[model samples]
Target chain A: MKLNRTNLEQRLDHLYDVIVVGGGAGGLSAGIYLQRFRLSSLIIDKGKARSSWMQSLHNYLGLPPDTSGRKLLQQGKKHYDSLAGDFLDGYVEEVTDAENIFEIQVKVGRQNSRNVKFYSKYLIVASGIIDHLLPLEDMQNVYDYAGYNLHVCMVCDGYEMTDKLCGFFAGSEASIEEMVFNLSWFTPKITIFTHGLFEVSGQMRSQLQEYGYRLVETPIQKFLGENHQMTGVELVNGSVIELETGLISMGARYHNTYLQELSLEMKGGNLVTDKLGRTSHPRIFAIGDLKVGLNQVVVAAGDGALAATQIWREIRKDIGPRKWLMNLKLPT
Target chain B: MKLNRTNLEQRLDHLYDVIVVGGGAGGLSAGIYLQRFRLSSLIIDKGKARSSWMQSLHNYLGLPPDTSGRKLLQQGKKHYDSLAGDFLDGYVEEVTDAENIFEIQVKVGRQNSRNVKFYSKYLIVASGIIDHLLPLEDMQNVYDYAGYNLHVCMVCDGYEMTDKLCGFFAGSEASIEEMVFNLSWFTPKITIFTHGLFEVSGQMRSQLQEYGYRLVETPIQKFLGENHQMTGVELVNGSVIELETGLISMGARYHNTYLQELSLEMKGGNLVTDKLGRTSHPRIFAIGDLKVGLNQVVVAAGDGALAATQIWREIRKDIGPRKWLMNLKLPT
Candidate 1:
């Protein structure tokens, strides 16, 4: 059920078997497995999945190379609904660990919204990260080509930029040192644009010169492109460098603030998870980009399955056979 | 390209970046990712994946619930082919580790066939397992209803047997002790059928009686049903016990004989790997049912992506920029 104001009031008192924090590919896949395993799940989505911004997914197995990320999520949502999993479009403000169950505080609407609290025995944090784009004056110009020719992930879109006149936009010197060399595997013609964010070290400058890579430290006036295809960039010095493709290697902001009070174990910006996506808290699981793993749609989907299956096994073992046989209903 | 007798001879001397051992979901997925990363891969399949016997896949997210496993494999093959990954219908006989590269021996075709050798820098063992069905007089009778109303995996088809009169066929007393209690989560009306294979202890018999479960030790004469739907079994004593569903808890045969020469790490029958599906050997990987993980198609697909990405990173680091930039071409 798509929980709205009318339906959300009644479900607030019910304790779900598992409450998923986001409805991206990972959350939806988790919900589907949980529901099929005869566990009650409520997926609370903030409606800002990073996959929603993907124009085309080329590496997901079995899917056509041109299939968009949104299309996959839509189909997943429909499949979850068919299995009778509850889904709500709400932003989770806070999660309080209440001994046995977690109290999740959610804000329902964008305007004149009411805050509500729901409870769940287990929680899955699938809230993914958001990538930071180039800090241009007109952010709309960056958005126009962000998911297109201006790609954010090299692992996903490197094939699309193979052997093209590519522009590497970096926010920090570390980003260039880590990724710029890897990007050369796809294309040799790379021009590094620092956007005046950080100074390049003398050692790094010599290495860049050795590789015949041009470095630009000037701030960008605007992205010069039409029809979601980035062509070049106009710098503050009024110089233009034509390019066929662009990569935004600026860092990203991880979205995991709701569980700040829990003080879960963290590795840098990501949560430290076991192979089953379990966090330090026994009942809480962190999957997808929020956990320490590769940020791919297929990998996240697999994480959801592993986490949900482990949770189900725990619940089934704890409840025992007689109680489960009497209490649970066939999901017909 | 689909390698055949004619084309296989020409590409015999060519070395691939990766050689996958199965054409199931995991091997195909790995091949897809490797090809997308501009690494050459060839998937040599033995033609019998456990998933190919799955009649309907209900839990794969983003797919219709009624979609068969064979349909997913067909689509995955098409997707892999679009990226120019080589696929062949041949059984790998042996794998010899030659330090940096591995030499694979394959037997092409069943009758009047020729043996061939292929070489690869990395190897992925996705050659999955085959479940052992009931050894009836006529095996066709078992195959007629194996993938339909009768089931093999409790994790995959437990929900499908909900609230029905279930018949649990166990090969050993251990299989009954482990799975029979879990089956009660879906239905309490379970009858344990030993088929005169193993003796039931008094403790187990009392436990079954306490739960109101029937224990039938008599060997069956034949199964009763029509049109691929099993209804009951006819015992040798001319007695019939009706059933709505059946679960075969027999074990499976793992297809990893070709890798016995490598002597990789093993946990029971599965390959013990790190989170990235890397075995004890650095250049070899194991995914899907061959690795110690959940036996879901989506999970295997995710494992493929992780293994392929890690391999790509290793290759990119070792090859360096100048060589990769000059050697690798755009996949178009």
Candidate 2:
């Protein structure tokens, strides 16, 4: 059943076998596997996953290269719902472990939101990192081509920018020093745009100069584009520079604040997980961008399945056979 | 291009960025990623992947619960072909590491087959394991329902056999003891069928007797069923034993014969791999059942992606950019 505030309260009477903290590819995959294992699961989604804004998924296997991330999520949601897995369009405020269960505090609706608590025997954190886009007054201007030609991941879209006039927009000199070297693999005609956010050091400036990459320190007034395809950028002092594509290397905003209280084992900004996607906390699993692994949609989906299988193995060993299978229907 | 014996010689002239062995889910997934990454690759398939016999992928995420493994493989092949990935239906004979590249010897056909040699900068061993089925004169009878109700994976189909009169067809007493105890979680009414393969130890017999399970020692048999649904078994002496389902506890044949000369690290039957699916040899990667991980379709697909990305990273660092992307097409 689709979970809403109305039915959520009543459903909380019984503890769920697993509570997935995101509705993105990873969480949905986990929910699908858990439900197939005859274990009850709930997936709470706040909406707009990192990949949702992606213009296309070029490397996902079995999918058309131009298939949009939004379409993939839509299809995944349909698959999850067909299994009768419970899904909610709400934000998870916090998850606190008590005794052997996790008490999740969730908030439903944006306006005059009501808080609800649900219990689960295990938790899967699939909440991924949010990319920091160009900080412009009209953020919609950035969104116009953010996921289009203006890409964030060089590992994903670098090949698409081969031999093109590429612009590198970074927030710091360190970002410029690092990203320019990486982007050099795609195109040598790179122009680093600091947008006057930070001062470029001599050492980094010489490194960029040695690489024959142009550096622009002008404060950008606005991005000039047509039909969601960015054409160029106009400086605050009235100079416009034309470019074929752009790479945004500002930084990332990891959505792991709710998990801060647990103080789980962390590597940089990600939670360290074993091969099976299990975290330091035995009952808590970290998958997708939340875990220290490749942040690909297919990898995230696989992580979910591994986590669900591990959880099933644990529960099965504890309860033994016949207990869970009695509740499942035989496949025809 | 679809690789057949006709174009195999001309293709061998070019050094493939990656040569993937076995055209199962893992190999195909790696092929898709390698082609998308702008790396030239070839997938050599011997045909009839183990999963090809799976009646239905009941637990695979995003697919319909009743989708057959053959159908999934067909779709994956179509997806790979659409990307212009080369696929050859042939068996690999041997792989010998040269100075920097690996030379692979392949046998193209069964009757009047010719030997072909191909060079690859990297190798991915995705040749999965083959299961041992009942060796009977009417083995075709077992094949009719091998992957249907006559399940091999308990974790995958245990729930489907819940509360049913399941039969355990094991080759060894040790296998019988282990599998029956594990299958007990699904149904307690399990009968062991020895088929006169080996002598059952007294200790193991007592253990089965204490579990309130039946034991049957038979010599000759043919499976009885209609439309691939197994109903019962016919013994050599014309005795019919009825059963709702059956579990084949035979062993598996790992397909890593080509790499036996490499002296690569091994843990029991599986090759140990790092998080990115890289084997002990930096240039070689093991995925699917050949690697030490969960043997599921989704996991194999994910492993292929991970291995391809890692290869890309290594190549990217070694040669930097433009060298490879120049061989790639820009996303339109």
Candidate 3:
């Protein structure tokens, strides 16, 4: 059931078994399982899933190597909708843990929006993080090649950049550690670009010299690329360095502001979760990039199934088996 | 590379980065990841994956509700082949763990089989379990509806049995506990059939009577059904008990016999694995039903990705980054 502002008002009184906070692979998978388990779930999505930006997902199992992450999410969303799961294209503003149920305040639209409250017995926080891109003066230069040739995750796109003239764009000194790992696994022709964000230590400079990797501390003027394929970069000093591919090791901002009121267990910017994706609060589960696990689509989808199954077990135990038939309809 | 008896001898000299013991969802997924990471892997399978018997998988994300498990395996196998992962249709007999690499002995054919040896740096034991069906005069009768109207896992098929005249077949007295859980989640109109295997206690009988459930302590003659849909069961005492659906709560035989040589930690029938599916032995891993986790296809697939990533990280750290270009070919 796709809920809009018109139909959302009538469904407000109904308490869902679980409320999923994103419509990415994880949230959609959880909703499909919950509906199959004979439980109601409402997915409130802000439509900013990081996977939507992925042009191609080469590693997801049972999918083609050329399949895009957006296509996978579209199929998952259709599967959830087929199971009659409630879906709303609204942003969750805040979540307050009431005694028995959690109260969710959602902003319905981007402009001329109205606040609405929803209730659910359990909550699944699948709102994933957004990666911080290179802070170039013209940000459009970065977007042209961000998902195509300029990759973010090394584990995902390292093979794509094998043996190429690669550019390792670092956000901080600590990100240089990941560059070393990438150099070992992918290509050795990597030039570390600081983008003038932070100063390189003396010891780090010596290590770079020992490895024979060039260090560029100048700020970038713009990326010189055509048709989403990054070819080279021009520095502020009007010097051009030709490259084949690039990796952005910049940090990301975790999208968990709605859960600020609930002081759940945290590990840095991620939520610490059990094997079943349960947080410090028993009723709340954090999965996908928000939790301390690999930010892969398949891993997040699996986390969703485990969390939904645990919630179903808890709910089934609380409410004992049905004793009477009572005009029961056959499960479709 | 699909290895048969002919090509199997030629590839015996090469050492793979990982050797997966089963070609199920877990092993296939692991093989796919290992190949994408530029690590060689070979999946030696016995071709008796438990998921092959699953008629349809309703919970796997992004797949249609009616997608058969065999279809999923086919797609996964194709994906793995596209990445040029080695695959063999053989049963692993034993694994001898040496200090550096593990030596594996395999039987290629079932009847006129030939012994073969393979070596790998890491091992993933994905040989899943096989459910024990009811022992009857005619075993084909049980197979007719085992994966159809009759089900095995309560978590997977409880919704399918909702509001139906369900026949709960128990293999042991402990299986009755699972029946109670099923009743709470599914249908209350359940009849417990002990198959004259064990004696029912007085307290248990009293509890069944109090809850208005029938206790049938009779040996079943045969199942009555048509077109793979079970209708009823005829007892040996010339009595017929009608049923709309059935659930077999019998136990399963874990297929981890090949790992018996290694003294790896085990919790009952499953291997004690870390969150990354790593066993007590650092080089060995366990996934799917062989490990202590949810027995779901998506969960097993996710476990494979995590285990393969960990192995890639270890190998990358051990072998430092390449120092020279050396006519490197682009990764396909």
CAPRI class of candidate 2? acceptable
Model 3 agreement with the true structure over A1-332: per-residue lDDT tens digits: 99998898779899999999999989988888899889999999999688888898887777777888889888888889987999999999999998879999999988999999999999999999999999998899899999899999888888898878888899999999756555647887878899999999999887776666778999999999899999999999999999999899889999899999999989989999999999999999998999997988889989999999999989988887665344243456
Off by over 4 Å in 3: A324-332, B324-332
Tens digits of per-residue lDDT for model 2, A244-280:
9999999888888888779899998999999999899
- Interface RMSD (C-alpha) of each candidate? 4.0, 5.6, 3.3
Candidate lDDT (C-alpha), each: 0.90, 0.84, 0.88
Tens digit of lDDT per residue, candidate 1, span A1-332?
A: 88998888779789999999999989998998999899999999988789888899888776777888899899899989998899999999999987798999999999999899999999999998999999888999899998899999998899999988889999899999999899988887888999999999999987887777778999999888899999999999999999899999898998898999999999989999999999999999999999998999999999999999999999999988752244234556
The DockQ of each candidate is 0.46, 0.32, 0.46
Q: List the residue pairs that clash in candidate 3.
A: A321-B184
Clashes of 3: 1
* lDDT per residue as tens, model 1, B228-291: 9999988989999999999998888999999989889999899999999999999999999989
Q: How well is candidate 2 docked (DockQ)?
A: 0.32
